[model samples]
Target: MTIAALQTVPQQIETAAIAQVRPKILMVDDRWENLLATEKVLKPLKADIFKAASGNEALSLVLRHRFAIVLLDVQMPEMDGFETATLMQEHESMTGVPIIFVTALSKEEKYASRAAEIGAVDYIFKPINPDILKSKVKVYLDLYVQREQIMRLNATLSQSNEELERFAYICSHDMQEPVRMMNAFAGLLAENAEEAIDEDGRRYLSFILDNARRMQKMINDILTFSRVGREEILLEPVDCEAILRETLSEFEGVIQDSGAEVTYTPLPCVETSSTLVRVLFQNLIGNALKFQNGSQPPLIAVMAEKQGRYWRFSVKDNGIGIENGFRGRIFTIFQRLHRKEDYPGTGIGLSTCRKFIRLCGGEIDFTSAPGQGSTFHFTLPSGEAARPTRSGQQAC
Candidate 1:
């Protein structure tokens, strides 16, 4: 036999086992006879059928187990189909559970519309059309199977991601010690043994110390990036305008040293982590000041415009713009376009911006041409959830 044929037996057995544990379907009616008829009609599907003689019993059964589809009767004691469906619609768990009303009611347009308003998926008459009933129920069953598969895959992927993040944290933490020692001893060598070394030897020692310092910064950034996601982030209404001003004040020395003229328009508050939002502005503004062409003072402007469900923010700078060829890797970790001698950086700033933007459920993009300056744009959750301000006063 061929190798493919040889492997068919075990595969078939596994498929059969999964199919054997059939999807659950709830059949609800005051009449025991009606419930039995549904079970008999649906027997070909080989599903795990649960019968309830009253609406109350059906609700009780639903609370205990998850059903792929619910076959409900319109006429019942204590509670009716509409009431039960309304209750199901309100429930957190049973909200997505499809319900098909097995009613003997007239086929008037209003009757169907009423059921729809109450969230009924479909309706069937007194004379159960076995073919139609099975067909409708089959769609929900297939959907349920697909949903189960997706949930399982998501769970597996989540576990793998958690493990990867843990590994990153451990590696970054372990690396800090060695980098610190190299930096400290290199400093000591430069200070105490400089008289005995030649000029080139001293130069080599300087390079070692500089690189060691850079490595230390990069390691600390990596640890922050890895650990931030694990930290408890309390999200709320954050005033974007206020955050920008506060960050600017903190970087007052850098701004004055660079002779940069920073200006911004009214910025709306957004729903996000206040701490991370400040970090994002700090990095973006810092990059603008750091990447100058040395001929003119930096002119940076920040603006926000609403775009549907998000606010599209732009940080425009008149400094050295990114070349089109290297733009693709701009957000990559530790990727720098300039040499360390010309531009001193660990290349972790923009990458951190990309990370925080995603964590807050948004995306980032930029437009730049070499030496013509660049405008970086990113989207964040709009200020719909922001705290209310006065009639004319801006919310920071």
Candidate 2:
């Protein structure tokens, strides 16, 4: 019979017997007799044996194949066991391979300390007891396999989290744009309606416009929050004063018409995204102006102070203050405390502000009592002064 045919016949016959074979073992020693003795001791376990005459050869074998246990002799010439262990740790695949020192030397304090320092998994003295060696090797091999499996599971979970975040961003962005267009057109239709339109028809049109706008705003806010979690941010020193001035300029017309008086202490410069900080301030100031009591001019004040690593900023408004119970719900999308006729908004401005603050590694909080004034507080990294303010304010 051909040699290949002969090998196949024996392999098929032994398949059932070999199913319970012990894990593979690699032996590295300068002495041929020690290698033979180790093989003989482990023979009863029916494990695959790999032999290396020197430390370098052992490392080479480890690179080419995986072993459950490595029996390394510490007294080998040239590249000693400790050096081999260090080199093994530097290899990505071999770093977790368990090393057991099998030597004839006595277990002295210094040797034990050095073994641990060199990352030996355990030390075994020569004239070894076969039973103890076999049991210890088996325990370590099982542990190594379990640890590798856990690492693989963690890697899989991390990948899944990243994919989910990406999907959320994509879905939110794709859905919100069309919703915004629908709301805009609905508003136009309501504004252009003729006198012949019935009261019920007008009411329905108003409901459609209002609810559609609310839904669109919620989707937009969700998209902003999701993007903050998924996108990498570029942080730099930002001029708070400049951003605030720009935001105020955008609201000049409303401020003029409302007879709102805005005063500010010099704001400290800080490290943040100027665009995001501007959004935060705009929302706070805009809310103050929009919610003023009837026929009363609004008084708004802005201030900042340095506190440890952060700048604490406050925007205080003498407007129709929030109720205590509704303060907590203010930063939630679509959570309006007032009716559409009482106040007009998408109910997303505060929530968007909170999201932007969190993205900049900051926090926003506020306190209010019904019929009293309210103050919104936030913080940003203290690094620089705010951008220069405009010399004077103009009416809206």
Candidate 3:
């Protein structure tokens, strides 16, 4: 078939096909002739073509419609194609829109390089070839349609995640209130028994109260974990050394009683969510002190170092340490090797720490062997590193 005939056939099919499929395109150029030329070149494609005579008008059309592809002219006055493409990228919905430059310039290396740098998908010279343009636009339009479908799927998935998080927060909050009430009334009954209850009855009541309190703590941790992703984290410079010192002071009584020797080199400033980082260090250090064995004083060390793209922090404790087999299981919620009477924890500390690290765009892991020592390691984005805020200062 001839080029004109070939182009005309698709236009006829597209007019009918586009009635059901509302695929759109934005055509941008300074010259009216260039704009008409692009429209003619893309006539065969099954799309709704919108025209704009300037970069500003192109941007307005982009804001109003989600175009499958943008045919842009490079040498427009005021805001050129590069500037227009950059502006389009700033919009979340337009970030992935395919941009093709239709310019009169020859195949020069500088212009070609600049086009790629500004994220143009293809470059077409003036005196357009209808057949070639038809094929090129067809390829990009098909890809754009596929991308739109993927975006729709992602939107659905994101909505589902939000719903799940809300459900967890509500369920955990509602469950804990009644559990606290049960513990309170159980304590009152134990204190004021009409006729002194038997030793067995007293033991059962104590167990009920203790378990209820533990459940309450777990529920609170679960709620915190669920909300971390939903809440907006205020990023700021945070002094790691100061936060650690304050956390140590909060556990002063425990440190003194256990005779734990805690030492740390100076920590550098890092950009992060201060509250979350404090909770992170508190849990790690507290675990170190809590798990000591054989009455040997716990020797804890906290250190930080710059790794590529992230800062790696380590908390090393010369305490009981974990077995190699159970190392992976320790970070999971309610997955404890020791009984409640022995460890005295609800087994939610490490799980909460993991959640906090993830919220800060980081990861937490560990290495341990029985009776040696355990070192918990975590990484935070280094680009976000900054001087830490003062102690007790709220993050903004």
The C-alpha TM-scores of every prediction are 0.68, 0.59, 0.60
lDDT of 2: 0.77
Give the worst 10-residue stretch by lDDT in candidate 3.
387-396
Question: How many clashes in each structure?
Answer: 0, 9, 8
* Pairs that clash in candidate 3: 237-387, 237-388, 238-387, 238-388, 239-388, 270-386, 271-385, 271-386
Off by over 4 Å in 1: 1-22, 29-47, 53-57, 75-92, 148-167, 227-229, 232-278, 289-313, 319-347, 357-364, 378-396
Which candidate gets the maximum lDDT versus the true structure? 1
Q: Which TM-score value belongs to model 1?
A: 0.68
Better of 1 and 3 by lDDT: 1
Ranked by TM-score from best down, the candidates are: 1, 3, 2
In model 3, what lDDT does residue 189 have?
Answer: 93
| Deviation from truth (RMSD, Å), model 3 | 11.5
Error of 3 at 80 (Å): 14
- All candidates' lDDT scores? 0.82, 0.77, 0.81
Where does candidate 2 stray beyond 4 Å? 1-54, 65-71, 94-102, 116-158, 229-232, 245-265, 279-396
- Residues 277-302, model 2: lDDT tens digits: 87788888888888888667889999
Candidate 3 residue runs with Cα over 4 Å from true position: 1-64, 70-96, 99-120, 124-154, 226-246, 249-260, 266-274, 291-297, 305-312, 319-348, 354-364, 369-372, 379-396
lDDT of 3 by residue, 303-387 (tens): 8877777778999998787888896788887788898788888677788788778878899999988788899999987544453
lDDT of 1: 0.82
